[model samples]
Target: MMLPLLEMTYKELADAFTEQYKKGPALAKALYGEFFKNLNPKAWQAEEIQASPGLADRLREDLSFSPGKIVDEIHQDGLTKFVTELADGVRIESVILPLKTHQTVCISSQVGCRMGCRFCETGKLGLARNLTVEEIIGQVYTARRRYGRSIRNVVFMGMGEPFDNFENVIQAVRVMSDQRGLNIAQRHITLSTAGRIDGIEKLAALNIPNLNLTVSLNAPNDDLRGRLMPIHNTVSMVRLQQALRAYPLKKGNWLSIVYVLIPDVNNGPEHARQLADWLQPLRAKVNLIPFNPGKNAPFRAPHETEIDSFRRQLIARQIQVQKRAPRGRDLMAACGQLGSGIRQQGLN
Candidate 1:
C-alpha cells in the first residue's frame, strides 16, 4: 500500500522514505519541505531533485494522491463552504471564515456522525465511517490551495464527533502542525468533541502543547444532556467531569465548556446555575452558542434577553463565560448547520 505522504508526520515521512527508497532523511525533508510550505502541485514534476528521472512522477502516480476535488462551493457573508469529494467518492464539507486578522477552517473527521445530537444536522445522516488521516488533512490542503493564503487556524468542528475517530484525528493534527508541513502552530488548532470522555483521557495523557480542547457540554445535567446528546447515555456527566478533572491543563488556561442554548430546552436560569455548579470544581470557561436554525431540529435559538440573563447568571457565580456569535448561517455553514445536500447526493 502506498503511504499518504501529505498526511505523514515528519518522523513517519522520514522513516517511510528510508524504508522504501533506501535513502536518508534529506530526501524526505527535501520533498516535504517544498510541497508542504508551498502546496504546489507542480513541485513534484520538477527535474532538479536528487533522484532518478521520472521518480517524482512514479511516486505521485502510485501513491494515494490528490487531496480530493472541490466539487461544490458556497460563499456568503464572508464565509466560504467547500464540498470536497474524496477518492472513494465520499464527500465532506469544510468551511473557511475570514476573521479580521486570520482565516479559520473548520474540518471534518468523519463523513457523517453517529452521536445523534438532536441539534446537529450531521448526526441526522448516521455514521458512514471515520476519515483517514489524509482525508482529514485534505480539507486544509484544498482550502489553502484555493484561497492562496496561509490558513491561520483550524477547528475539528465540522461534521463528526472528533474523538470517535481519535487516532486519525491525532495523526492528522501532528502532520498539519509539523514544522516541515503546514506548520500550523499547536495553539492555532482546536479539537471539539461531544464530551467523549475516553478521547479526553487519551488527549490528557498525551500532554501535547498549545492544542486546545473544547467539550460540547450542551446541558447542565445528565437527564437533560442525555435527551439532547446520545453519547451521554454511556459517558455520563459525572464520568465526563472526572475525565475533565483528570485532564492536564496549564494553570490559568481553562477548558472550553460549549453550551448550545436551545430555547426552552437547555436554557433557563436554573440550567445556568446548575451549569455553574457543575463547572465550579474544574478550570473552565463556558461558551454559550445560540442554536442555529436547522430543518429537522425542533429547537430554536434563545432570545437575546434569555442569552444575556444566562450569561449574567454564570457571571454572578464567577464562572467565565462568553457568547459565540453565529457565523455562516446564510450559507448553512455555521455550527449545527453543516451536512446539507450530501444526503441527497447519496455520498453517505
Candidate 2:
C-alpha cells in the first residue's frame, strides 16, 4: 500500500520525514515545495534533494503521486470544463472560469450527489461516492497545469454538495491553503452546500478562518424549498437560517445565498420578498442564478424581464443581490448543468 503524497499536509509530511528518515523539517519543506512545484518526481531540482543522497529516490519509492489523468476537456465562452478519470475509472467534472483579473476553478466534492435538488443535473445521478482528498485537490492541480492560468479562487460548486463530503473536502482545503503547497489563501476558497444543517453546524464549529460559505437557497419558505430541494425535508429553512446566523463570519464577509430562478416556480416577486425576509437574520448576499436548464429539465429558465423584476424586488427590499450571468451553458458547464453526460453513460 503506497501513501499518497498529495493527500498529506505539509505538517504531516514533515512529521513523517522526521520520524522515518531522521531528517528535520527543513528537508521536508524542501521536498514538499518541490512536489507541488512540478507535481512530478522527475522534475525535482531543489538543492535539498541534491544535498541528501538517495532522498529523491527514496521519496519516489515510498510516496505515490497519483492525481489521476484529465481524460476530457472542453472550452466554451471563456469557460473550460475538464473531466478527470480516477484510478478506479470513476469520472468527475471540474470547470475553470476566466475572471476579470484571475481565474477560478470549481471542483467537485463527490462523484454524484444525493441531495436531489430539482434543478441540478448532478442530483439526478444519485450518490456514487465521496471524493478523496487527493481526488479533490487533484482537480485544482490538473486544471492549473492544463489551463496554464494562476487560479486565485476555488469553489466547491462543481458536482456534489460539499458538506456531504465533509472530511475529505476539509482535508483538501487544508492542503490547498497550506503555504508550502498550493498556497491558495483561505479567503479565496468557497464551499457551497445544499443546506445540510449537520454539515453547517460542523463547519461553524471548525471556524475555519476566512473561508467563504455559500448555501444553495433556491426558495424562501419550507413548502417551496421542500419542493425544490429534497434536503429541505430533513433540514427546514428556519433551522438552516438559524445555523447560518450562528456561523462565525470574519469582518466584512457575508455568506452567499445562491437562488436558482426557475420560471413559474420560485421566481415570483412574492418569493423574492419572502427570501429577503428570511435572510434578514443573517449576513448574506443573494446571488441570483437564472436557471440553466439541464437535460430533461423540469423547469425552464426565467425570462430576462422576470429575472430583472425579481432582482428589483430584492433590491427594493434592501437585500444585497447580484444576478449571475449564465456561462458555459452550451458546454453544459453552467450551474446545475454538470453530471448529465456521466449519468447518461451509466458511469455513476
The top-ranked prediction according to TM-score is 2
lDDT per residue as tens, model 1, 63-114: 5657888999999888999998887888899999888888999999998999
Q: lDDT of each model, Cα atoms only?
A: 0.84, 0.87
Q: Model 1's lDDT to the true fold?
A: 0.84
Residue-wise lDDT of candidate 2 within 284-308, one digit each (tens)?
A: 9999999998777888878899999
Q: Candidate 2, clashing residue pairs? A: none
Each candidate's TM vs. the true structure? Answer: 0.95, 0.97
TM-score of 1: 0.95
Q: What is the Cα-based lDDT of residue 268 in candidate 1?
A: 79
What lDDT would candidate 2 get against the real structure?
0.87
